[model samples]
Every structure is written in C-alpha cells, then in structure tokens.
Target: MQSDSDRTGLAIGLSLVALLLFDAMGLIIKHLSEHYSPAELSAYRNFFGLVPSAIALWSSRAWHAKGRQLWMRQWKVGCLRGMITTLAQFCFYMSLGLLPFATAATIGYADALFMTALAVPLLGEKVGKARWLAVGIGFAGVVMIMGPGSQSFTPAALLPLVAAFCYALSGVLARRMDADVPSPLINLYGTATSVVGASLLTLALGGFSGIRGPGDLGWIVAMGMFGGSAVLLLVISFRMTQQANLAPFHYFGILFAFVLGWIFYDEAPVDDLMPGAVLVAAGGLLIVWRERQLRRARLWGARGPHTRI
Candidate 1:
C-alpha cells in the first residue's frame, strides 16, 4: 500500500544503513587484519555471509511465486561474479590492513568509474562524452589519492584500485544475468562461490593463522554479520526503487568512512583526500545524473508525445 515516494524514502534509508553496516564490516576487517590474512578473512566473511543470502532468497515473495526454483539460466554469470568478488575482497581487505581506513575506502570509490567504463565493452552500452568526461575526472581523483611518485605512495596503494576494478567487473557481470532470477538467489550463488574460492586462496596463501583469542573470534562473527546484512539491505533497496535513484547516495559511504576512520584511528588525511575527494564525488554524481536523464528520455519516448506531463 506504500506510495512510490514512500518506497523511495524507505529505499534510501535502507541504503544508508547498508552503507553504515558495510563500513562497520570494514572497521572490523581493519582491526582483525593484524591477526588474519585477507584470504582467511574473505573466506570467513563469505561463509557466514551466505546465511543472509539464503535467508533473503527464502523470504523472497517473487522467488516463492516462481515455485522456489533453484536453477538459473545464467548460473555461469553468477559463478564468474563470485570469483571476481573473491579477488575483490582479498585485495580490498588487504588494503584495509595496509592503508589508512579512509584512504582505502576513497580509492575503492574508483569502482563507480570503473563500472561506467566497463559497461561499454562488457554490456555493449554506449558511452556518451559526458560520462567519459566524468570517468576522466574520477580517475584523476583516484590518481591524486594514490599519489604515485610521492613519498606517501607505496605499492600497497594499488591494492584498492585493483579491488575496485574487480568489484566493478563483478557488478557489470550482474547485468548480463537473467532478469527473472531473484537478486537474492544471484547473491547466494556469488557468495557460495566466493567461499570456495577464498578457501582455496587461503590454502594457497599458506593457510589461516590461529585466532589469538575469543575476542578476535567474536570480531570475525560481527564482521560477517555486518557484511551479510549490508548485502541483504542493498538487495531490498534496489528492489524498492530505480537503481539510479539510489546510486548517487553511495558516495555517502566515503564520508562515513572518513568520519569512522578519524574517530577510531585518529586518521585525518585531509591533504590526501581534499579536492580529489570532491572531484571523485562530483564525477560519480554527474554520471548518476546523466543516467537518470537518459532513462527519463527513454521513458518519455516510449510513452509518446501525447502523454501527460
């Protein structure tokens, strides 16, 4: 019975909460990085994260309406996304251990720009000059944060950039999936694959370290809960409204990351994140705005000229 406006407001609120939960997971990952390898953490996260994905799938009315089908026409796409997600988590989690919390997170924002670029070849979508310009602006901001050739820049900085690209690739692949498949089901596929992939990666990386204490174990559980819940909320939000309506708000995560970093780690990398962060946000917002404009144009075109304003 909720109106479109009410659904949009709820979606936006849920999206914000999801972002906060994701940041909370990141905080826990950063805290535990000293005691665990990224591979181990990735494996643990995906393992526990599967619970929420399964629960979401089970709770989906649409999925239930479909007679609880377990098969997907694009199962390969889901598997590929899972593999990519495994790599993304490994790289991002590694960066969280090595870089400033905000720095790693800001760099990860490059995923938006990467997604735009990848959509062209990967999705066969046309890229307009405006969006390409936005990508350039965003890339420049990413480079500013990386600070290559500066003393502050290290090889470690590249980890988050790599992570961003993998994440973007995974997202782009999702668009190639069958539209009829439930998002929660797709998510479950990816998470399950990630679990296996991360486990193998952990074995290859010389295996997991022993937990130092129950505190670390508790933190691991909290990390998985935060991440899994975030994914669930994001899935629900996307279903509630147009993705473009929610896309721009993702930048809020960067601000939250910065605040959390400052509070927890006394990290205030203003000089490193200043105008660059502004440019990054502006570029992403511009892309979102352009997408919305194009969608509206398409809608109007489909409705014909006689449609009411």
Candidate 2:
C-alpha cells in the first residue's frame, strides 16, 4: 500500500503528465486542422476516444454495478451533460484551428470564471465577493485578449469564449449528477454524444470530403488517444490526492501550449493577448486560492472551535 505522502507525489506527477498530454492533443488537433474540418476532427477524436473509455470502464468494473443499469440512476441528466460536452468540445476544437494556440488556451482557461458565475444558479452555491472580483478580473482578461472594437477582433476569436461557457455549463451538470454517475460512464456517454453530434454536423456540411490519406487518419487517432489518456490520468490524479494541490498545476498546460506553439507553428501571442494571458492566469490563480481557503475553513469549522485548553 502506498502512503498518503507517496500518493500525493504520484498525483502531482500524474497531473503534470496529464496536462502535457492534453496539450499534445491540442497540438495534434491544430496540425490536423490543415487537412480536416473541426467537426470532422471532433468526430475522429470522440470515436477513437471511446476505445480507452471502454477499457477504463471495463478495468474499473464500472459498466455495471449490483442490480443497477449502466446509465446509472439519472440517465437523463447524464445525456444532457453529454450533449453540453459535445458542443463545448466542438467550439474548443474550432477555436484551436482558428486562433493561435496560446491565445485559444488563455481564453479556454477562462471557463473557470464562467463556472463561478454559473454555480450560483446551477449548484446553488454562494459566490463570495472575492470570487466575484476574481471573475471580473478574468473577464477583463478576456476582453484584453479580444481587444473589442479593435482590428484584432476576428469573429472566430469568440469561439473559445463560447466554448468556455459551454464547458462551464457542462461542468455544472457533471457536478450535479456526479453522485450517481461513475466517471467512466460519464466519459463514455459524453464521447458518444460528441461522435454522433459531430458526425451529424459533418454530414450536413457535405460529409468527410477532406480525408486525403492515411496521414489524416493517423493524426486523428493520435489526437483521440492523447485526449482519452489525459482524462484518465486526470481522474486518477484527483482520486490520489487533494484536488487543491493539483488545481494550480492546470495553468502549467498554458505554458506548455505556448512553448509548443512557438516551437511547432512558430506562433506567438500578440502584445495585447500576451498581457491578457497574464491577467487570465492571475485571475485563475486567485480563484484557486479562494477555493482552497474556503475548503480549509469548512474543514476547520467542521472540527468545531479549537479549545486552547
């Protein structure tokens, strides 16, 4: 058996590896965008992703519990989450193709800000003034990236913001339904939803006409494998240690995305977007800090007043 300290270290290591793998998927998606539509690539991602999800489900014995269905108790809610996740990923993949990786990543990370606001209605969670302030700062960071009313505004630049909103909504659903739904089932349904949705949209757009060769197939499969593996690693990491300890490491993906962007695509954020990225990063850190404080307070309160006898 691993000690708590050993598990924590392992979690941290896994978290870092997961983030890198996620960035690798993003890089692969960006490269494949030259050969396929975002919708088509999304289909590929979800299709191949199902393979690992099935493996994880089988390995964990999550497909069927004692006398329970695979859909768990709340099948409707799970399906709704799946639909929301599909749209979120489609928007994100589109933005990945349309914008610089660093810029797209900065905006996508703003989903944390969206989630804070959405939590008020969805989760019935109270947002303190500090968190609201963090949310404001985060949105400001987004505007800095967008440069509203400026020549820097490309319609496609808004795709990531849409993606962020959809992601936040999906996260809200996931939190609400997490009690009854196992992670594997959640992943399975979500990937299935994406595959079907993307396929429908692609067919409506005139089918997969861009698939030129096996190279395209290879890129798509690689993207899917990296994406699925990242989710598995992230799930394991969170289960291993305190989530607060792992929360900060999420920003590490942005840094890696920037480095990867520069190296492969020779891409760099513009002057304004770079500053925006800094602000977004800061705001995200503030939110994480505030959450940690809240969690600690709850734990302390649960312990009752410490009698300094």
- The candidate scoring highest on TM-score is 1
User: Please, what is the TM-score per model?
Assistant: 0.98, 0.93
Kindly provide the TM-score of model 2 when superposed on the true structure, using C-alpha atoms: 0.93
TM-score of 1: 0.98
Q: Which ten residues in a row have the lowest lDDT in candidate 2?
A: 60-69
Backbone clash tally (model 2) = 0
Kindly give the number of clashing pairs for every candidate. 0, 0
Segments of candidate 2 deviating more than 4 angstroms: 61-69, 178-180, 306-309
